[model samples]
Each structure stands twice: as C-alpha cells, then as structure tokens.
Target: MYDSLWKALKKLPLLPRRLNYAKAPALRFLDLPEDIVYEIVHHLDIRSLCNLSLTCRQLYLSLLIPHLHQQKLPDPFREIHLNGDNCTAAIPALRLLLYDSPIKAFTWRAGHDPRTLVREVEQLRRLIARMSAIEYLELDFSNNWPANEFRHGHENGYWAWVRLATNLLHVVAQRCRVVVVTNHYQVLVPWVTFIGGVPYNLDPPLLARMCAEWRASAGEAEALGSTKLMKSPSKISLSHPDNAPASATFPQPFPPEKGSTVYATRRLIVNDPGLFQRSLFGEWALDWVSNMPLTHLVIHQGRMRLPLLRQLRLPRLTSLVISHG
Candidate 1:
C-alpha cells in the first residue's frame, strides 16, 4: 500500500521542478562591435566566412567591408574559377563578392554542349562588364573534346568552335588586360606567369582579322602621336581609327610603349600550330605577331619559323615555350 501511494505521488504534475528549469542563453554575435566582429571574422576561411554571413543581415553588412575582405580572404580575391554546371548557380555568390571585392581574373571551363557553352560565355561577359577593373580572363573549351582528339575538321566542329572562341576573345580583350583561350588544359596562374600546353585548331582567318583591326587602330594612334590628347580622360576613345576624327585617334589595342605616361602592358598566348605552318605562314601570320603585345608566347606541336619570329613586335617577351608538333 505504501509503494502504491509513492508511485501515485510520483505520477502527479511537478510544478516545483517546472518552475526551477531555465532556458539557455542565446549567442549574440551581432552584439559585438563591428570592428571586433571583423577581427573575429579575420580568422575564418572563405567557407566559414560565407556561412557566418548567412546567419543574419548584421553579419552580412559587417563582412562587406573592403579592407576586411582583402585581409581575410586570399590575396587577389579576384581570381575565380567556374565549371559548366556551377556557372549559373555561382552568379549570386559572385555578385555578392563583387559588391565590395574587385575581380581581376576569371576562368570558365565549358562543358560538351555547344549551346550551353555559348550561354555561359554570354553570362560571363555580362558579369565582367559590371566590374570596374578586370585584368585577366580565360575561357577554356578543351573540356568539350577528349584528350586524344586534336584533329580539326567539321567532324570536330572546328569552324563553329573557332568563330565562338574568336568572338569571346574580342569581347574579353575590350575589358581585360590579358585574354587567354585554352583548348585542352587548366592553367592556374595569371597571364604574366601562365605555364601550360598550347591551344589547337585556331582559325587563321579570324585571327588575321583580329590582328588587322588591332594593327590598324594602333598605327592610327601612333600616327597622331598627341601626348595631351591621349592623356585627356574626357577625350579618350578606343574606336577604330577610321571612325575617329582626324584630330584624335583611338588608343592601341594593347598598351602603348612602356616608360611613356600613356603605356599599359598586355599579353596573349596562341597555341595553334596550324596557323604557323609553312604554307599558312603568310601576311596574316606576320600581321598577327607584328600587332600583338605578347610578353610570353607558348606554341605546342609546331615549329616557330625564324621569319615569323623576326616579325614579332613583343619587345616585352620574357618567356617563350615551344613543344614538339
């Protein structure tokens, strides 16, 4: 009877115990001053920082500080890489980063589908256009083809591929300091120190046209040679010289000669051996080299003829890599 009575008492609601229980204190990261919060954030890696930002609006705004981003994130937080699938998904993150951080270099690796590749390229172009500063941009199409496949023809869709590549290059060159198009490899470093295999099956005619436009525009600027006119920000123009007034001319496709006040340096890499072959090495090849401001040149699976080398105007050429064709 005593045991039953004790059990009945135990089953009764316990107001005293419920009154004694207390809730745990909440973490108040936002309670900290902005400076202190940034200091704490400094120790976080990119992933951690991104997670922290998602916690609340207060943390998001605090992390957007430019100095904090530069100090906490990898130096030159500018270099970004995107694979085919992630390109669309990564845009929101990219825009958030660009809200305070500057993007200097970007690389996009395309997938097999030609339509998707074109869309991704267009998207990348739009993203680049928003940035106030962009130096190096690389569009890699090598992922579309297998490693062993290097032959050029309709079977590989060489013409369509070249046309797209050329168009992309033209768009990138307008904004970026160095534009790199790779056919079958990944280059992690920037253009200044690029080390990799050569690009293949490049269209000579399109290259020739690109070279001709650059040469003609550069020549026109040189002929005008007005230091005051070139320096004036309000009057600066990059139009084709023929389109400009005779009194002023467009700036060179690449920077003008170094040491001069108006000079800016640029680099290019053409890995296409077919364009440099003996039969194809004509005025187009000469024009391409003579106009380019390439500081480093890498040609794979092809020989660099002495005459073509002679035609190069890359006084700034520091590194040259040539592999067996």
Candidate 2:
C-alpha cells in the first residue's frame, strides 16, 4: 500500500523541489528587504513618491532619502508665463517661492523711456535672483530704448534697474553654474535681451553695460562668449501701413544661424512698427544680451526681395535664408 501511494503522488502535477523551496515563505511580505524595495520605489516619479509616502510606515521611511526624491513632480508645480503686457507672473506656486519655485525666466517688458525702463527693471531684478536653473529667459527691450539720463538720485528708479540687472545676472549665472555641476541636464533657456519701452526706444548703452557686467561675473573658462545670441525673424506684416507703404522697407535676405531660437514664423502681422520691433527684438533678446554674451548673428526668415524697402546691409550676418509664399 505504501509503494502504491508513493507512485500516485509522483504522478500528480507538482512543482519541482527547488522551485517549491524558493517560493516566498510566510511573513516575507512584512519583512521586505530595503534594497529591493528601494529599487522598486526609485522607479517612481514625484507623484509616486508622494503616494508611497502615504502608503505605510516602512515605505514612507525608505523614500525619505533626500537624494532620491529631490527632483520635481512630473507635473510642474507652477505655471509661469509672459502675459500680453509682458509682465512675468508665476501662477499658483507663490507659497513655494523660495522653496520649490525657483525663477526660471524673467523680463523687463516694454513700457517707458530707456531711463525709466532701466529703473523699472529693478523689481524684475530681485525676482531673477532666486532661480537656480533657468530654461528660457526673456530680457524684453532690444529695440528703441530712450537714451538720456542724469546721475541723479540713488533712489531714482533708473539707477536701480540697470545696476540691479547687472547684479542679478551674476547671481543667476552662479546659480546656473552650480546646477550644471550636479546634473547633466540638457536644458533650452530662451535668455531674452531687452529693456522696457512704452513711449521711447530701447537703451543700447544700458544693455551693453549689463552684458559687460554679466560676462565680468564669470571666472576664466566659465564665462560665456557671444555665440549665444538668437537671431531676429523676418518682417511679416498682415496689414500694410498706409503711411509706410509695402514699398517702404523690403524684406532683407537673411536666415537664422544654426542654433537660432527665433525661426519658423507661422503668421505675419504688423500693427505698429513699435509693436513689431518689440515683438521681434524687445525685452527677450536684450535680456539675453545682458545676462549672456552673444557673438554670432542670426537673421531669421528673409527673402531675396520684398516689395518694400530696398538695400539690405547686414554684413555681420552669417546665416541667410530667403522664403516666399
């Protein structure tokens, strides 16, 4: 009878002895080892990090390694944008201002004369100081800033802006450099170059000063040269100016440089020459010129000839493209 029972058991479908032995034993779930669990947890992102934090005591404790979960949530905590008026506003994340919310980009939008915009750029300067990593930056006033000023008062808003931008550039650049040391993050930051202008043109003198100061901030080998400058787009007017005829200014034949950020203009519209100027080369371009040095020149979309202004003189322009639709 014993021999018959053994033969029947052998015929049954059963796992191999080694496999049975390797099966998870009782109480194994409660005693999950740290390394295995941590590796599993490492696969999750910021949201999962928060979820695991709420899972249980063991999970919460293991995920607390500041090194593992310091990065941001997959969904951005804030939505920062440049408004129609060119004001910089960080939405919904004000509480994390000094913490998770670091400034990524800044702009001194067009408004007053050069002297005035320089003054107004003060408030913006303070904001740029906090961002450690800036992906896209806008320095708004690259066109027609008013020129003329007095040494005047220390409190004069004018003195504050240019000086403030200069100082802030140093601070922001240091912050960016630090981030580079820790992570190999390939980021695209649109460093805008500009000063504000409402009534007057851009202040070229102040912009150069700002650039000089920013380049001065870096040590040898760390300093960014002039190659960072993004080019301007072709002049596209949706509506022809009655005062400035289609024959007023012909399209210049120039294409954007290899890395030019401003390209692929979908629709062309012209409301005001001033507006077009700002839209093309205002604060965003100027700010880049200030914070980072720009060596190369890129001329955006251009045509061999437009029925506008004649004679194009852009000798320094290296890249050229002519498109007609």
**Which regions of candidate 2 fall more than 4 Å away from where they truly are?**
1-79, 83-96, 99-108, 112-120, 142-161, 175-325
Clashes of 1: 2
Q: How good is model 1 by TM-score?
A: 0.42
lDDT of 2 by residue, 44-70 (tens): 665555565656776555554332223
The C-alpha RMSD of each candidate to the native structure, in angstroms, is: 16.0, 21.5
Model 2 C-alpha lDDT versus the unseen true structure: 0.33
* C-alpha lDDT values of all predictions: 0.48, 0.33
- Residue 95 lDDT, candidate 2, scale 0-100: 18
lDDT of 1 by residue, 101-216 (tens): 33555667765444365456656656654555445555665554432333322233422433333334434544444545555322211111212343544444544444444434
Query: In terms of TM-score, how similar is model 2 to the real structure?
Result: 0.27
> Candidate 2: deviation at residue 74, Å?
16
